[model samples]
Target: MTGAIGKPTPYIDAVQKVTGQAMYADDYKFPNMVYVSCLRSTESHAKIKSLELKKAEASPGVVAIVTGKDIPVPFGVLSISRDETAMAIEKVRYQGEIVAAVAAETIEAAEAGVKLINVEYEPLTEFFTPQDSLKTCTPDEQIHAHTKDHKNIHKTAELRFNEPEKELETAKHKQTGNFKFAGVTHGFTEPHSAVAMWNGDETLTIISATQVPHYLQKNLSKVLGLPLHKIQVKKPVLGGGFGGKSDPFPHEMIVSFLSKKIKRPVKCTFSREEVFITHHGRHPTEINMSLSCDDGGKITALDADIIIDGGAYGSFGVVTSYYNGVLLQGPYLIDKFGFRTRRTYTNKHQCGAMRGHG
Candidate 1:
């Protein structure tokens, strides 16, 4: 109690929230605003054989229809791995990937339009786990073509100091462990939502419930081919991010593109199921850990090998590939230490930052 900086302080915005006076992204209203709904892919891994949108374009009250071809540029939170398109262009790496989007006068019309769009997919060999990805495969079979040696391995991070394996052999006590972890998602009450408006001067304004507005703005510029100055991103009262809303999502780009094309404000809000598909959460991992202790109970060495599941795209998997092993080096002292982490691309929701990042 003596070290407590202040006595039980209240959140500054708690009063407004309790009074129901706070504004979330979905709370905004505008004249002639349109609603958007996406047609997601049903296959885990597949090539787009064909996409027919005539029915959707002629759907009742439908105003705009956009697909991957409309916005081909890729965007992600990290620059090196911006591998996500606004919608599935050539292929979809995971189930529930957005393939097309519709904008209409009413939410019902948008939903109806989404169902009218027709798509044909050629199913490909899918890898669902890190073990499945590590196996040798044909170049065309790999999830990402750029990966070397025809493997699904996205990243492999290793660090070594003072030969931990040799040191552990000479220790008085040594313990080894194999741990498995399941994936987790942020289940916030308020779903993800965004509203995009194209100003008269060819500028764009986006209001979203996000934690990283600046990052979103930068990514929007990349995919939309608009200059940084032409796009303005605003973050509303976030119900909670927990790092889930930190990434620049495909839906954000989808809504903005439709708004500019139709010259009207477009709004998109996800259902709970859609939220799960856009997951950027902790990586599911299997870790092999070893620790050594001397006769005097002093720590001697530590070594770990981790294999993490990085579904679909590389969100924060690059950093996570290192963090799973590197973080163990801190807050403790060991004479010898080493670790290796291998991240594999899988056919599921891509993982990114989350609470603890474990």
Candidate 2:
């Protein structure tokens, strides 16, 4: 172990990747391959009044179009909160939520078909900040119906080891601070891509650039109404993940459903702009922390109040809410420690796992 510590270990696939021999999801092509383009919502928060896809169906080279009704099952990384549909269902919580999708002979035709679709939405009250999200809103204004007390709070994690607040008040030496951190994106080298093929034997095969294939397979079965054994998920050469690609994404399910609908290969590759819109990155957080120390310089007590802006759907937010508080327990022994983390839903791209778990 000591001898290998300073040695440079080359990546197993470094040669293949460097020589352009690595086959990525986008690089795979089939004989009857179709392309998919999604029609995203324009409003940050709105109820979809009407969706007209007749024009898109008649668009050049267009084969099929699917909305939320086609794949109605909801899915998320955590089973406790499966709130996201493959496409926007009754309402669009965020501006870029996928409302519908178009499958066509070519990528250009699919994109053109997407442009032809018309959707009508009734505007709703939007929550953009964690502070606003903490307040109770009307049932209609609430981002998710499941939220408690009509508030946009997704998860509230609280843990207490001892009386930290009491200890802080009595301690001679103590410090308190408030911090605000901006949200960050992964900005991986390659945008997301997926290729789905419906085999003649009534099986489904999906090649995607993702880090969690098992979760993707499970979600695909749930959304597509197929048995686990009948579905196969393959991971090709991924450009980068950094925990951003850990969730089973909507685009992956969109392409899979489209392929099964038309019984041909279907592919969807996100543009650079789409990549940013599909962000599952580090959360925008606000924290108020207090700590106490004795004259001996050993930590006595610690406490924190944290708020994380979890935009739109609940991805891995439940776990993230817990991680934000529990992670502080390590690397130090503070007998009295307490924390409360509130994850709030907002009108923006969803935040999830990143380089750091929380």
Best by lDDT: 2
Candidate 2: the clashing residue pairs are none
1-358, model 2: which lDDT tens digit per residue?
Answer: 4688879987899899999999988899999899999999999999999999999999999999999988899999999989999999889999999999999999999999999999999999999999999998999999999999999999999999889999999999999999898899999998899999999999999999999999999999999889999999999999999988999999999999988889999999999889999999999999899989999999999999999999998999999999988887679989999999999999999999998787
What would you estimate as the lDDT of candidate 2? 0.94
TM-score of each: 0.97, 0.98
Q: Please give the lDDT score at residue 346 for candidate 2.
A: 96
Q: Write the per-residue lDDT of candidate 1 for residues 283-303, one digit (tens) a residue.
A: 999999999987888788999
Candidate 1's displacement at residue 319, Å, is 1.0
How many collisions per candidate?
0, 0
